[model samples]
Target chain A: MKFLGVIIVCLTGGLLLYGTTDFPDWGDPSSPASTHLSDYYIEKTIEDTKVPNIVTSVLADYRGFDTMFETAVIFTAGLACFILLRDFRGKKERFYRHKPTGVVLHVKDGKKTLTVGKEFEHMDKDWVPSDLIIKTVCRILIPFIQIYAMYVVAHGDFSPGGGFQGGVIFGSSLILLAISYDLKTLVNRIKEKVLGIFAALGVLIFVGIAAICMPMGGNFLDYTALAPLVWDPHHVRALGMLGVEIGVGFAVMAVMAIIYINIVSEGRHDEGL
Target chain B: MHWPIDLIVLTFVIFCAIAAISVKDLLGTAILFGAYSFMMCLLWAVMGAVDVAFTEASVGAGVSTVFFVAAVFRTSRRTKD
Candidate 1:
């Protein structure tokens, strides 16, 4: 099997290297990739969409439907991870420890075998002591990271970031909190149900905007149709782009969190590494 | 390709990619893969595709590295490879 893999890799690499010879030189002005659609987009993006960032206008406005479906793809991935990993079967035996005299009690079923006591710790054998430095630093820095993520998402029209990048950044902050403190701490703050809703809601917002355009007289995802109710046609396209970006941001953020939580917990959210 | 810095980054990227696959420790492999991603990010930045570079830095070097570490944490660290 390994030999076959190596042979396949060698063949693929040889083909790719051969293919690269036909590609235009780096930064060639007359390259097909640079000449064909690039010229049109570079020249017309500002005039048509009123957005300075060509990538953003192209991704969110010119190809709004594609972005909407891309957001849906992320949403679907989150749903798939949730479905594949989530375990509904009964949990294993749990042990409870009394705090007063250091006594351990094991419970097999959910028959309320032990009476509730305020002085009892749940005997979290898997729990680890969070690092003081890590917890303190993450607590201080998470807000700033989140603010920067929001900034990236909002300023994507003029910057080098957009929904997908900003969303990943935002999701990373939550994951950082999880790593610094614990899975329980992060889960307590943001419930799985909320993440699921956000995932679906994000895609819904994207499709909803596009579908609204259809009813307003223009084709699907046509932002010009929105001008009658809001702003100039050019500005409407920019606004539509912003709305699409926000939808993509929400979808990507939820999906990243969902995938992380599911993978960490092995589909059972009872405890995580 | 810009010769000096780009070549340096490309060399480091290849080294890291090879090292990542060769490492016996799964955790070490994951970290090396993250380094490879950072190098790729630098290559894209040098190529002037700032949007692609930004996405690679955030996704490849940032979130992907975190995911790799988390996966490594959940799984066994030792590997036959």
Candidate 2:
């Protein structure tokens, strides 16, 4: 049966390779991607928005509607993680197998034998300390990564990096902290409550920007008419785009980290050491 | 037709995925799954799907590996040869 399964998998992989070969060429400037419905987003975005990331321009302004749902994607992921891993926060985790209430003998420092139970230390023997160099590097890199993510969010009118890429990059840096230090340390760094609040706030901010345009008798995401404070329509549009992008970056980063942490921590405690 | 770097990344992805499915050691299988994600990320980047590559690199290469390994932690990692 295993042999037959292997053969079937191989055939499926072969089909996938054959299909991908017919996909759009890598980095083809004239492909269907570069020629889209919105020419202004691609051609004049740099000069108008004062940003230099094309993908960002497309995501933040031209297609902000798609991005609203994208933030919800992250929010749903966060909710899923919370539902899967956490149980009443303050409650102590129970063992999968029935652990006896009696005391247990543990050896420490080779000379002293200790009996601990009921409320023993939560530390596990297999838990390894993070390397000094690695942890130091993670600490150093985090600020730089956040700066880059912000830059990407800020400059979506001239280049490739946009909200989604910036969000994932930001998420990875947080995961790095989790790996280099420990889950508990990350929990402290990014509190669950803060993540939930920020995610909802991001959506509200996006809607508020839309509401500003709605009263002016323009389309819901019309950036061209969002002027009055700034005479230049371009400036107001750019400002609105960036505001939404920042929100997306935060929501995605927070939610992905939440999911990763939940899965990791649950797996750890479930397997009694 | 002449993407040597892509060829290397694609080869790496294929090998890792194959090894992940084939390995008798469950722990090794989980680790190989991570390697598979990393290679897929690299491959996507080479193809200029930077966004797709970014998500894959973070969620697939980094987090998914941790998830699978954590799962193995609760169970015996030994597999019958």
Candidate 3:
């Protein structure tokens, strides 16, 4: 404990302060970030894609390959989480968890073993937890939060929101459920198996959209080839970009949620995967 | 959206990160790290990076926190000197 305190004072405190210094001076008009590769996207994207939102253009069309890998990053994270945390016991092997011999007790039922650590405070099994009120609120809030995340994705062509934002919002909504209710509920409701699938599918969606352009294509993600029937290639391009955003959003949300779940529930146990 | 509010949010973020990393207790640090993510979300929103804001909020604030806690479980609380 004392060592960490000293390390933070010596190392982290200064670095944290350093990281925030000036920080591009808050949308400086002269900043390169506000000017170059993005400037082209901002100006040309709306005309080419017919989407008012410029960031979406950059993410999906201009540098979509980056987005695809970003999705893969999430996919890898999910895999890592599963490998780190998911319990794997052959159906025949009886579950035996190391409990704190003096105080911790283990109760097994079927495939699950709930450990009671010595330091754990006893609660009546039937008692509703204190966070239930917040849980109730989350139950009500989840649909709205999810809907808003989707809206962020759908409207990425218009304004400030896009895949990464929507993904975070989506992931947070699931986290709220875990926090307010219990992790067990979230695990049950959102199966670990499903999250892995979505992560992969997200990458596929982005790559698939881009690959379509190659055949009748101008470039890897040339949206004009997508719907040759559409008189305005811009509109078709915009639609394709939207699809890419949806994919990215799902991948990011699923993988992040998985990471959190692994850390919170199983990692603390300090057992080998 | 609000400048002062945003500044406050940013300040809180810095504070949390400092607290999280600096704290002697690993569990405390892990929990504070979660708070840092939530604050970062607010900072992203205020900066008009709504997409990054949402991602930070969800992953950093919510899920990442859980992951850290779980990681803590698998490891000892004390940092080996």
Candidate with best TM-score: 1
lDDT of each candidate versus the true structure? 0.84, 0.69, 0.72
DockQ, structure candidate 2 = 0.39
Give lDDT tens digits, candidate 1, residues A111-187: 55555568664434465655799899999999999999989999999989999998999999998887787776778
| Interface root-mean-square deviation, each candidate | 1.2, 3.5, 4.3
Q: Lowest-lDDT window of 10 residues in candidate 3 chain A?
A: A90-99
Worst 10 residues of 1 chain A by lDDT: A121-130
Residue-level lDDT of model 2, residues B12-56, one tens digit each, is 988997788789989899899988998888888877777567668
Task: Point out where model 1 deviates above 4 Å.
Answer: A1-4, A95-124, A231-234
TM-score of each: 0.91, 0.73, 0.72
Residue A96 of model 2, lDDT score: 19
Candidate 2 residue lDDT tens string, A1-273 = 989988998899899989999877855666676577446665787776666666666677777788777777778878877787765433233211113542333334444433334554333345554589988998999889878877765664445555656776777777777777766567767787886777677667777777778787778978666786455665787777876777777777777676666666662322121
Compared with the true structure, what per-residue lDDT tens digits does model 1 show for residues B1-81? 467998889999999998998889998988898889889989988888899999999999888887788788788889855
Task: Tell me the lDDT of candidate 3.
Answer: 0.72
Off by over 4 Å in 2: A7-51, A89-137, A229-232, A267-273, B49-56, B67-81
CAPRI-style quality class for the chain A–B interface of candidate 3: acceptable
Q: How would you order the candidates by DockQ, starting with the best?
A: 1, 3, 2
